[model samples]
Structure formats: C-alpha cells, structure tokens
Target chain A: MINFEEELKRFFPSLEIEDSEEAIYRQDMTDAADLLLGVIREDYAGYSETPTE
Target chain B: MICFRCGAPLSESDFCNACGVDVRRYKKIVYAANSCYNDGLERACVRDLSGAEHSLKQCLKLNKNHIEARNLLGLVYFETGETAAALTQWVISKNISGTNNLADEYIDRFQSNQSRVETMSTTLKKFNKGLELAQGGSFDLSIIQLRKVLSMNPKYVQAHNLLALLYFERGDFEKARREIDRTLDIDRGNITALRYLNEVNAHLGIPDDKNSKGIRIFDNPSAQVIRSGNETLIQPLNDREPLGLGAFIQIGLGVLIGLAITYFLVVPAKERAAQEAANAELYAYGETIDEKNATISELESRVSALEQNNITLSDSLAQYEGSNGAVDANNYLISAAMAYIDPNQDATQVSEYLELIGDDYVETSSSYEFKELYTYLLNDIGDSVAQNYYDTGLSYFNNGDYTLAISYLSKAYMYNANNDNALYYLAMSYYESGDISTATDKLNTLIESFPTSSLVDKARQRLDEMSY
Candidate 1:
C-alpha cells in the first residue's frame, strides 16, 4: 500500500517562470571534461615547477 | 572532436596539433557522452521518456557542451510538465552553442506564442496550488484544482499523477486507476504513474499479469482480464448465464425498483449537473463576447483618431496648395520667367510679375528652381531695368518727391548695383526726407560700393555732418 502523505512529500514545487533565472544561474555546468582539464592543468603546473638540473 | 583547452579541431592523432596537449582521454570522454546521447535518443524513440531523461542527463553530466543531449533532456522535461525546467535546459544549451543550435528553435517555439506561455504559466500555478492544497490535507479541493489544471492542459502529466494520488487517497480506486492510465498515456515511462497503477490495481483486487506489461483497463465495465496458465484472456467480467422463470420475475422487479430510484434521485442530480455545465458555458461565452466588444471599441476609437488625423493633415496640406498658396507663388515666378524669355515682353512686365511673387516668397521660401530661374532672369535684364528706374527717380527727385524718388532709386540700385548715380540720388533723396539714419546708411553704401564715384566727397561730408 502506498502512503499518501509520504508519497506526496516526494513531489517538489515546480520551478515558476520567475524562478527560472535563478535556477539557470545556480545550475551546475561542470562536466567530466572540465574536471579532467583541471586535473591535467594542475599536474602540468606542478611538472613545470621542477628545476632542470 | 575539439580540444578542451584551445578549442582547436582535433586530428586523428592522440595529441592536439595546435596546443600539443594529449587528447586521447578527452576523445574518450566525448565518445562516452555521445554513446549516452545515442542511448537516450533510442529510449526517446521508444517513448520511454523517463529513461531517455536519465540517459540524456548522464550525457550532459559527462559533456555539458552536448547540445543535442541538452535539447532532448529539455524535451523530456516538457513532456513531464516541467516547462520552466525545459526552458532552463534550452537556455543553457543556447549559451553553450550560440549558432545553428536546435535549442534556439525549441525556445522560440515555446515562447513565441504569448498565449501558450500564459497557459503554461497558469497551468503550472494551478498544479502547484493543487499540490499545496493536497499537502495541507485538503484532498477534495486539490482534486478540483488539479482537474481544472488538467482541463486547461490535458497533456500535463504531473497534474494527472497528482490527481491520481488524490483519488487514491480518497479511496476512489477506479478513478485513481483512470487518472494513472491518462498519465501513462501522455508519458508512457512515467514511473510515478506506473507505481500508482500498481497500488490501485492491488486495492481493486485485479489480477496482476506480468506477461502483458503496461496493459491498462479502460472504462469498459464488462471487460475482464484473466490469466489461464501462460496465456491471458479478456472476457466479460459479468457474463449472464441463461435464467429460469423465477429469475426473470426477480430481475424484472429489480429493474422496476432501479427505474424508480433513478427517476427520483439520479435524474434530478443529472439535471443539476447539466444546468451547471450550461451556466458555465454561458459564462464563458459572455466573457468572450465582452473581450470581442472591448476589441471592437478599441478599433473604433483607433479609426476615429485616424479619421481626425486625416482631416487635420488634409487641412494642413490644403494651406500649401491652391490660389493663395505656394502654387500661386510658384506660378507668379513662372510667369516672370516666361515673360523674360519672351521677345515682345518688356522688363516692366517681367518686373510686375516678379513683384507679384512678393518678398516673402524670395526671403522665406528657398525653392531651388525658383531661385535659379529668378536669378538668371534678373541678371539678363538688370541693366535695362536699372536705367528705366534711374530716369524715373531723377525726374522724381527734381520734382521734390523724395519718397517716390527714394523708392524708384532703391529699385534701380537693387536691379544693378553698378548704377552709382542711382545710389547717389537715393542718398540725396533720403537726406531730403529728413531720415538722417537712412540717409547715412545709403551714403555709406554709395561710398563703399562705388569708391570711384564723384559722390564720395559729398557722402563723406554728409557723414561728418550727421555725426556732428
């Protein structure tokens, strides 16, 4: 048997037109490629820091 | 594929040719995102929208620059009545790829029609209100609000699912099942609707058949689902067997009682419902008529304003047309030009026509053709006209008519500035008229314009006397 109150709690309020701007601004756009680039750039920076003997 | 760092086009090699960064992993990430997008597209084609939504989101999470995946995800959101969510995804996608992006078309399609946007906005508001009402333990009011929302936008799956939940809570398993069926009809892969269907079926004691999945019972009361071993059968739920005489008498009595009850109770309630529907329809028609009347009144006022504007413009236009207008001035100038070119017409006739054109036309109106033609004609006969006016002025000056002499001499000097005698006589006439200021001006003009004239010493003596 489904619990009506508990099931209703799963439903969230819809994003109104007024709130769309904030929702878009707060949306996470970071992807796997972005993460990989960040990691590679960090490693490259660290590698360049080593002195050439 | 493109390089993540410099945005350069990728080559077949594992490294970027431009920036020299290793791109083997980046290619793999993009390839994986494309695979997710393909999976989402397949799911979407099969109307498994929830599955499609999940795969598309995974694609976007892997590659936020995947515009196709974003657009498909937006479509999925729109299908599930998440219009604002759909708009956000499309907006982000448009920002990610500005040109030749399908997101631009999708956003334009959704937003170009203002009425559709308003309907969507209102439907969303009512759905939200319904959800709030449900949460506040007002199940009946929520059902009514959700019904209204669904009536406005029948394809709103979320509203249907919420209505189903309300029905299920109110112990209306049949209506709940119907609502769930409608939700699934709009979005086949709506998991909430499927789960609710499962619960409603359980409550109604309907036999669950796992073989034919997603099969929903419609409003057919006689239709039955039966599983015989591995196969399913759909026969009538209440199949009437042959009845004996006693059974017939009992059925006939029951039918009579049913008719009596229906006539006494159900007919009146049905009539009230019909009357309410008619009243509601009449109110809708009244609102429409009022809106049309307002539009008609606005257009009528606009027409009246335009007519008034037309009358004012016509009046203003008429002032620049006709006998006392610019046309008359132009005609006078044209007549003067014609007379100057005529072999028989003298300078006096041309001068008379030119005077008819008036000073206002020459001083105020800067007509290019008028100025050109008038200047040419005046220059052609200026010397002869000056001699005529100078003779007339000398006669007037000797007769002691200084005002008439001044007028004629001024015309003579105006026609030909080289007539130094005309200038000297105009100064003498102004001096005799006792207008010392005018006399001084004419005397100075005579001395400055004609330095070799015999009147220079006389003009200097007069200026000295005026100063003293």
Candidate 2:
C-alpha cells in the first residue's frame, strides 16, 4: 500500500525539469555490451565529418 | 541444465538428484536467460541494436558464460557508435570461449588496424580525465568531457555510465534516465546501470522491473547460509500477496487534495486579482473626475470675472448715452460754445447754458482738455452775465419788484461771487420784501461780504436799528 506521508513528501516541489543537448547518433554503453567496453567497431565514418577531437 | 547445488546433470526434476537440493529456481534462471537470448536474436535480426544490446545483457546476467549473448551484445554496440564497448564485449567473449569463437573474427578486424587501437587507448586516457573531474565535483565539466569522448569514441561504456551517474547526482533525473537507458541498451545486465536505474526508479516511484529475474527469493537471512560443521545450507522464502483496499484510499485522497488546492488556493487568488483590478479602475476614474471638476471650477471663475467686467463696461457705456452726466456735460459745453461764438446772442444765455453743466461732472472729468475748455467758457461768460444781471436787478429794485430783483441779483452773484454790487442789491431786495428777520440777514451778509464797499455803512446802520 502507498503510505500517504511518503506519497505527500514526493510532491515537495523540488523536482525541476532541465534541458540538454540531443545527439542523434548516440550509443548506449551496455555493461553487458561492455563488461568493460572493448574497442571493437570501426564505423566512425559519420562522426568523422565533424571531428570533436 | 546442470544443478547449482551439485556438479551433476539433471533430468527434468525440481531438485538435484545427487545432492537432494531444490533446483527449481536455478532451472527458471536458465530458462529466463534462454528467453532473453531469443529476444535478443530477434532484435538483432531487425537491426534494433539498442534493444538487442539490452536483451543480450539480461541474458548474460543470468548466465555470464552465454558466449553467443556476449558476442552478439558486442556486435550490437558496434552498430550504435560504441566501438570500444563492442570490442570489449567481444574480447571477453573470446577469452571465455577460447578456440574458433565467432568473437575472434571481430577481434581480428580490430587488431588488423594497429593505429586505431592506439587511438582507442588514448580515448581511455581521456575517460580517466573525465573520471577525475567527476570525483573532484566538477560534474558539469566532466559531463562535457564525457559527451565529447562518447562522440569521438561512442562505444566508451564507462563514459556513458559516468555521465549518467553525474546526472543522477545532480538532480537531473531525466538526463540520468536517458543515460541509464542508453547504458542498459548497450549493457542490459550491467549491475551499475541496474543499480543506478533502481535509484532512478525509486525517485520516479516505479518498481525495479528489470531486477525481477526468475531467481529464488531468500526471506530468512539466518537460514540462507548456516554453517554446520564447515558446511553451508541455503533455504528459499516465498513472497506474500498485497492488500488491495489501502491502495484505493491513497488514490482517492490524492484526487481530493488536487481538487481542494484548486478550489481554496487558485480560485481565491484569481478572485483577489480581479477585485484589485476593479479597485484600480475605480481609483483611476475618481482621479479623472477630480481633474474634470478642477477644470470646471477654473472655467467658472473665469466666467464670473468676465461677467463682472461686462457689467462694469455696460455701466460705463450707459454714462455716455442720452442725458447722462457725460452726455449732459458735452451738450452744455457745445451750447455754450455756439452762444459765445454768435455775436447777436445774449451773454446771459451762455451763462445759463454753462450753469447747466454740473460742478460734479466738471470736478470728476479726468480729461485735461474738458476741464480747461469748461474753465475758459465759464470765466468768459461769468463777467458779462454778472454785469447784465446787476443792472437788471437795479431796474427791478427801483420799480419796487423786490422779488424779481432778488432772483436776478442772486443769479448775478452766483455768476461772479466777488461782485459786491450784486451782493448788496440782492441783500436789499430780500430786506425790502421780507420782515425784520430777512432785513437783519441781508444787512449781516452786506456787512461781512463787502466791508470795503459803500453798502457796508448802510448795512451796519440797518443791523443796529434791527437789533434795537
């Protein structure tokens, strides 16, 4: 059951939405994908157009 | 499937045949792992790289030795701009399954380009810099560096996970959730990701649905691993169902609170705003009315002053009209001028006309020209009129017409107040016509007025007789 006090505390007005930059081509770093992520793929063709480095 | 309790294969039984230990939970774990693997394979076929990565990570969590899952998860990471994470998964998979593994081919491809491998190591060093920044409480700087690292080397799992962790700490839960979701997609069974997600879920008020694998529940903390003569025993605990009515009450109260807040707070605030606006309008109108009244009062004062001025001007205008003082003065002066200029006209007539001009009008005349002209006319007319009136009075006195002589002599004296003859004869006429009182008054006037004249002797003699 939902405790009313705990539930009421959730509405304390501190939660504020923040904005962030969106990158279209984003990769998720899965731990399962990388128990410790390995340098494997070579599809850096699209990202190379705008070199961040 | 092999039993977790016994190093022996089992044949479709809930318990291990060799150890007499229940293996129902373990079998379900294996089944769940297989189910995830199947789900991953379908996602991979459809090129849903993120989903496949997620499903495969779940599969690996249940059975870390799932070679196909580890290999596939790496491949999925590669397609989604995370080359380092993909290669890392493949390398681990190949290490686990040493010979002729499918991960070997992927690893060979990476090893073939030695320069690229060096660059990948450099990316790792940058990742370390981002880590130090985060530890130093420079979360914003760390986030920037980590995003840059991900863009350059998108497969950097640590970068994505750290970035998410920073967001989670900064109260940027949406960003944290996005990062955590991305991390889970690449590594579905990542404990750090799952743990962070549970925290995110707790803040979000959702259950940890991902952690609910087909694992045995251990309720009694004491019984799960009890040491009995250097041997440990494990037991499982079952979960109880929830009571439903309490959930309903909280829902009903939440709705009631939302309604009360709108009615008591928001509605009153709106009404107060409306009333304040009305008061402001009323105040503005009052000011406008005050201004208008001030203007009207000023206009009325001006009009009253103008009306007073008009009345004064009208009275002044009436003074110059027919038979008023100004007109009478001008008429008498004109008649006197005409009579004086005419050689045949009588001097007495001019004197009579000049007399018609009142002393009040002449004294009040502000004009220098009017006063000078009137003075000259009066002097010229007075000499001739006094002589003529004096002779006429002597004629009347000799004829015994005393009343007539008195009137003529009085006129003669008025024209020239210094004429002693006119004064003496006028006094004698009054003495002869009146009683002793008149005789006495005449003698007193003759004696005082003409003390040097011949009339003074007779006047004193008459006065002595009257007194006797």
Candidate 3:
C-alpha cells in the first residue's frame, strides 16, 4: 500500500501532514471504528472485495 | 517536541536524557546561527554592506552550515567592489546549498559585457548634453554638468575627453590640459585625450619635446648686428617719411614770397592810412580834451556853488529847527495824543517826519538820537497821560475789580471804542462779578460793533455759555 502521507510530501513540499486539519479528522474517524462500522456495512454490503484485513 | 530521528522525548539539554540524542544542543546551535543570518539579511536589506559582511561572518562562525550567510556575504562583497572575493564566497555558498540561485544570478549580471556597455551609454548621454550646452555658448554650465558625470563614473573616457574640449573652446587652455591629464591618468593609452593634448600643445607653440634647447650664438653678435644695420632697408609704401629737400625749399621760398608781398603791398598802404587816421584822431582828441576841460571847470564851479548853498541851507534849517523846537514839540504831542486815541489811524505829519528821522538814524547807527525821538514821542505829556489812563484801565480790568474796571475801561473805550482786547476783558470782568445780564449786553454790543475782531469768537462763546 502506498504511503499517501509521504507521497503528498513530494507534491506539497512545505506541507506538515500531522498538523493538517483534514488528516486529523480522518484519524478521528478511523479511531471511531464502532460508529463507522454500521454505516460501512450498510453502504457496502454487496461489495465482494471489501477487504477484511 | 519529539526527536525526529530517534523518536525520543527531547530534553532541555542537547542530549536526550534517556537516549542521549543531543537534539536540544543541536537546535540551540541552529537557532543561534539563524539569528545571526537573519541579522545579516536585514543589514543587507538596508544596504549596509560592511555591517552585513560582519554579521554574516558571525553567522558562519556560529554554524558552518549557514548557507544563507555565505550567499549574502558574497552579495556584500560584490556591492563593495570586491569582485574576486564575492565570487569565492558565492561559489562556497553554492557548494553548501545547491538550491540557492541568488549567487548565480549576481555572477551572471555582474560578469556580463552589457553592464559596461550600459554604463558607457549613460555616460555618453551626459557627454552629449554637456556638448550641447557648450555649443549653445554656455561654457560654465557645461563644465559643471560634465564634472558631475565624471564623478559618477570616473573612468568615463569620453566624458573626460569632451570636457577637455569644452575647456579649450572656452579659451581655458590650462583647465583643458588638466582634464586631458585626468583622462590619461585613468587610461594611459587614451588616444583621443592624447590627440587633444597634442593639438593644444601645437596651438600654444609649446615644443613637443620634454627638454628645452638653449639659444645658439654661433657668429659674432656685434658683426651680425653691423651687417644687418648696413643693409639699406627698403621702406614700405605706407611708411611715413620726412618732407623732401625740394619740398622744404619750395615751402621756404613760398613763405618768403608771401612775406615780400605783404611787406611791399600791405605795410605802406596800411601805414599811410594809419597816419592819416592818427592825425584826425589826434585833432578830435584835442578838441574833446578842450571840451572835457571846459565841462570839468563848469562842473567844478557848479559843484562848489552847490556845496556853498548846501552849507547855507543846512545852517538855515538848523536855525529854523532850533527856533521852532517848541512848536515841533507841541505838534508831536498832539499827533501822539491823536494816535493813542485812535490806534487805527495813520501816523500824523509830525510822526511821519519823526519816522523818516528814525529810519535815517537806524541807517547811520544813530541809536541814541532815535531813542531820544522815540522817548519824546511816546512820553510826551498829553500822550503819557492818555497811555496812563489806558494802562490803568487794562490793569483794573485784568485785576477783576469789575466796578473800577468798568469805569476805567469805559474811559479807555471812549478814547478808542475799537479796542477789542479791553472790551473782551471788561466783558469777562463783568461776567465774573455776577452781572451776567450786563456782561451779555456788553458782549452783544462788542460782537455787533467789531464783527471782524479777534475777540468776537471769545465774546460769542461766553454769551452762549451764559445763555445755556
């Protein structure tokens, strides 16, 4: 898997990824996995290749 | 803050206490270096090249990795005219920071031939303007502008050359030579300034050689002078010469002929005529002298007789005056009395005679006689009495003795009713003595009688005040 953060570093050389508001919000969403789990299931139940790992 | 390399917690010290990372110490060094670099950058921004160089040196001393300091230090050196040193510094800075492009830009701009060309073009424009002024006959103004251009770019060879030309045009050969010398000092091979220098030298007749040649004395100086003197010099056509001998002889002969003609033709005729005229004049003079002598004798007799008659008349007049002294005294007394009574009247006949004598006495410095006559006229018995009455009246009136002033003033008024001074004073005396109605009546009569008198205004003012 590509490290999006490092790839973005090449595009925006002056960027500070950990200090970015969008990156922080994404981290918060990942941390609330239980709250996102039902929404994810309802939205992609028919998708066969939704990786479980 | 965490250590980036080791994921260690950064300590206050350079070395992480747990992992010995040396992070804080390195950060401190970087901060110091950056501070000095920033200071150097600020000084460079203000165009303080020397101060910027010093700050940048300090930055480099603090941290050898300060690439910005090295690059800016090069800029400072370039600004201060140290081109080689600037190139060295910039190369080192570029080595340290390959991303820095400032040093490259400066090197490219400064090393180009176009820069010198542009400078030359600006200097040429200044020289052209100076030339224009010089051609316009404003030499002083052109010299001033050319001097400013030379100061801005001293190596402007064309400006120095043209400035020399302007000085030469103004007849200032010394200044022209000095300007050419300046150009030569800058560039020894300056052909234009050199050519102008040679031209000035040729015009001035100064030898192009450095050393002076002494005068040669080959031949005998006295012999050469004698030879040159012996040569019959040809006189120019316009040369002035003395009159020829023939012309002088002719002038002398002409003058002699003129003298001979005047002597033979004019002298005898003029002499005979003068002799006849002299004889006639002598006869006429003799008769005139006789007539003049006769007239003189007659005039002498007449004068002597008139003198005798004058003496007799003078004696008779003296005798008559002596005999009529009392009558003259009486006449003077009456005239003086009349004058005192009517001060406006002309002097009587006796006073007129006295005035004539007074004028004669004044002209002859006979003040004593004039005083005697004046005293007799002024202090005669009748005139003195009248004057005494007038003075007593004036004194009484001035003293505010209204009843007595009225009586004395009335008597003086009878003698001369036109005495406005006495009348006005008398009216005031009456007014002061609480007889307002009497004072008003007196002033009314004075005003009506003496309309042109000086005291009329005072009388009217007094009457108006009393009425109010």
Candidate 4:
C-alpha cells in the first residue's frame, strides 16, 4: 500500500510568479567549467607566489 | 569557443592559440555539454519531457553558458506548465546572450498576452495551495484545488500527479489511473506519474509489464517472491482462491439488501409522486372554481347595473305620462287637431282638448312646430269658444256656482284676451268666490286695458267698491 504521508512529502510547492525574481537572484550559476577555471587560476597564482625558480 | 584566460579563440591543438593556455579540459566540458544538449533535443522530440529536463539540466551544470540547452530547458518547463520556472530559465538565457537569442522570442511570446500571464499565475498559486493542503493531511481539499489547477492548465504534470496520489490515497484506483494516464501523456517519462500508475495498476489487478520503465520504482512487500533458475516469479499474496460457500452467502445477502433498498427508497418515491400529482390536480380544480366564481360575480354586477338602468327608464316613462308631461301634452294637441278635422265635431270638443294641452307645456316647450300648430288651432276656434265659455260662466255666476264660473271664465279669458264679457264675468266670479284681492286685480286690469269700453266704467265701480 502507498504510504500517503510519505508520498505527499515528495511534492514541494510550485514557484509563484512573485517569487521568480528572488529565485533567479538566488540561483547558483557556477558550472564545472567555472570550477575548472578557478582551479587553473589558483594554480597560476600559487606558481607566481613561490620563491624564484 | 572563446578561451577563459584571454578571450581568444581555440585551435585543433590542446591549447588556445592566441593565449598559449591549455584548453583541452575546457573543450571536453563544452563537448560534453553539447552531447547532453543533443540527447535532450532527441528526448524532447520524442515527447519524453522528463528525460529531456534531466539531460538539459545536466548540460547546464556542465556548461552554464550553453544557450541552446538553457532555452530547451525553459521550453520543457513551459510544456510542463511551470511557467515561472520556464521564465526564470529564459530570463537567465537572455541575460547571458543579450541579442540574437531564442530566449528573447520565448519571453516576448509569454509576456505578450497579459491575461495569459495572469491565468498561469493563478494556476501556479492554486497548485502550490494544493501541495500545501496535501502536506497538511487535507487530501480531499487538495484534490479539489489540484483539479481546478489542472482545469486551468491541463499540461501541469505536478498537479496531475498530486491529484492521482490523492485518488490513490482515497482508494479510487480507477480515477487515480486516469489522472496518472493524463500526466504520462504530457510527460511520458515522469517518475511520479509512473510510480502512481504502478500503484493504481496493482490496485486494479492489472498485470504489470516486466520490462516497463519505472514500474519497480516502489517495492510492494505484499508480493511473495519465488526464485527458480535465474528467474524470479513474483506473486501477489492478496490474490486468493474464492471461498465457495462464504462467497455464495455474501452474494445472497447482497441480493436481499438490494430488494430492501428498492422497497424502502423506490416505493416511497413512487407514492410521493402520486400524492404530489393528486395535490397538483386539486390545486388546478380550486383555481378553476375561483375563476368561475369571479365570472359569476362579474355577471351579477352586470345584471344589477342593468336592473338599475331599467328602473331609471321606467321613471322616465312615467314622467312622460304625468299631467304636465310631454307625452300627455302631445296627445292633447293631437286630439284637438283630430277634433278640428272632423266635420260633425263641435268647436266645444276641440276647445276642451286644446285646454287639456296645458299653457305651461306650450310656453316652456322647445318644439316650435308644436307651439305653431297649437296656436293655429286655438285661433281657428277662438271667437266661438270664448262666446260659449262667457255664456256658461255668466249662467254659473247667476246660479251661485262661483267655482264653476271661475273655471270656465279663466279658460274663456285665456283663449280670447280682448273679450270684455269674459273679463267682466271672470272678475265677477272672483268677487263672488270670496277672492276680493284677485277680484280687485281683475277690475283694475279691465279699466286700464279697455278704457273706451262700457265695461271699463263698471270695472272702475267694482274696484272702488272692493277698496271700501
């Protein structure tokens, strides 16, 4: 038998039109490519920070 | 594609040509995003909106700057009736690619009709409310709210799944199956709809397809598992052999209950209908009686009015036959005319008939012809009628019958005003009748009116004697 309470918990409230602006503002736009670029930039900064090589 | 380091284009090598930076991983990420976008496009074309949404979101996670994947995700969201979510994706897509972007067109189309936006807003609000109600354990109210939401936006997969879940919870397996079927029609690979369909199918005793996708999303513990030679045979424990005697007895009890229901519900309904029909007929009869009574009263009033009219007409006829009435006066004139026309009839007969036509009738009447005719007849017999009256009055006066004398003398004087003999006798009759005042008046009239006559001196002598 379907546990109605357990099943109902899966459904979340749909976003309303008024909340769309806030949702868009709070969205995480960071992607895998951005993470890769962040790693590469950190590596370049670390190399420049090291003593003369 | 542009390099992240210096905004320079890349080459076939593992590095950006202008920036001299490694771009092999970045190119792999772009290629992976492109591959995901291709998969999503294929899934969307096949109407697998749920699969498409997964692929498109994966593409966006790999490369958020993928405009095509982002636009497709918005379309998938719009198709599923998540307008605000779709608009969020499109708005982000447009911000990333300001010009020559498909998101611009999508946003323009969505925002063109103000009423459509308002309707979608209402649909979303109702769906959220339904979800809230469901979470609060008000399943029935949630079902009603979700039904309204689906009526406004039928492609809303979330609302359909929620409504189907509600039906399943309420044990309405057939209705739950229908809502799930509608949800699957919109989003074929929807996991929620598939799960609900599985539950509904199990409740309805429909055999589940072994190879169907998402069929085993929820495990049914009531099924007995039997393993035989690398194959598992699952049998539902609830499917039982029928109880021969107990089932028959239950069927018999159901038939008896049906008959009882027929007797309790149907029989009274038929009797009430009969009673209502009888009451309606009685009310109609009463209305007809009231209408007939109204007609009778109207006719009675008409008859009463006619009776009053008849009485007024009778009174009018009686007035015409009275002493001074027009009918009586007309008859007297007609009689005088008839007597005057007869050769054997004496002037006395015509004169008496003319006297019957009262002086008031001749003077006050409107008929000129009647007055002219009466005057002509009176003048024709005036001299003889006056002489006869004067002789009768003189005889009556000498016989001491002053009343008789006065009556005849009055007529004689009325017919011929110039008759001195009639005037003298009329005055003498009044003197003998104990009317001294009237006698004096007549004597003075004779003296003033006929000064040259021998009766004038006699009249003056009578007047002087009356004064003494």
Predicted candidate 3 versus true structure: per-residue lDDT over B1-468, tens digit per residue: 444335567766766555453355456655776888898888777655545777788777656546668778877654443344566666555555677467677657755876754554455456557766765668788788789777766755556776787777666776777787776655454556667777765554444442444222223332111112112122234345557997799889999999999999999999999999999999999999999999999999999999999999977665444433434633544565566467575434334444333333333333455456555554343243444446787787777677887766654554455577667766877888888998898899999999999888888999999998
Report i-RMS for every model.
Answer: 2.8, 18.8, 26.5, 3.0
Candidate 1 per-residue lDDT, tens place, A1-53, comes to 79888899988888887789999999998999999999888988857643243
Each model's lDDT: 0.86, 0.70, 0.61, 0.86
Tell me the spans in candidate 2 whose CA falls farther than 4 Å from its real position: A1-53, B1-43, B46-75, B79-81, B85-331, B340-348, B360-413, B419-468
Best by TM-score: 1
TM-score of each: 0.52, 0.33, 0.22, 0.51
Q: By DockQ, who's the top model here?
A: 4
lDDT order of candidates, best first? 4, 1, 2, 3
Q: Estimate how well candidate 1 is docked, as a DockQ score.
A: 0.35
lDDT: worst 10-residue window of model 2 chain B: B223-232
Q: Runs in model 1 with CA error above 4 Å?
A: A49-53, B210-468
Decoy 4 TM-score against native:
0.51
- Residue pairs whose backbone atoms clash in candidate 1: none
**Candidate 1 chain B, run of 10 with poorest lDDT:** B209-218
Q: Is model 2 an incorrect, acceptable, medium or high docking prediction? A: incorrect
Model 4 chain B is weakest, by summed lDDT over 10 consecutive residues, at B209-218
In model 4, chain B matches the true chain B with a TM-score of 0.47
Q: Each prediction's Cα RMSD?
A: 34.9, 19.6, 36.5, 15.1
lDDT of 2: 0.70
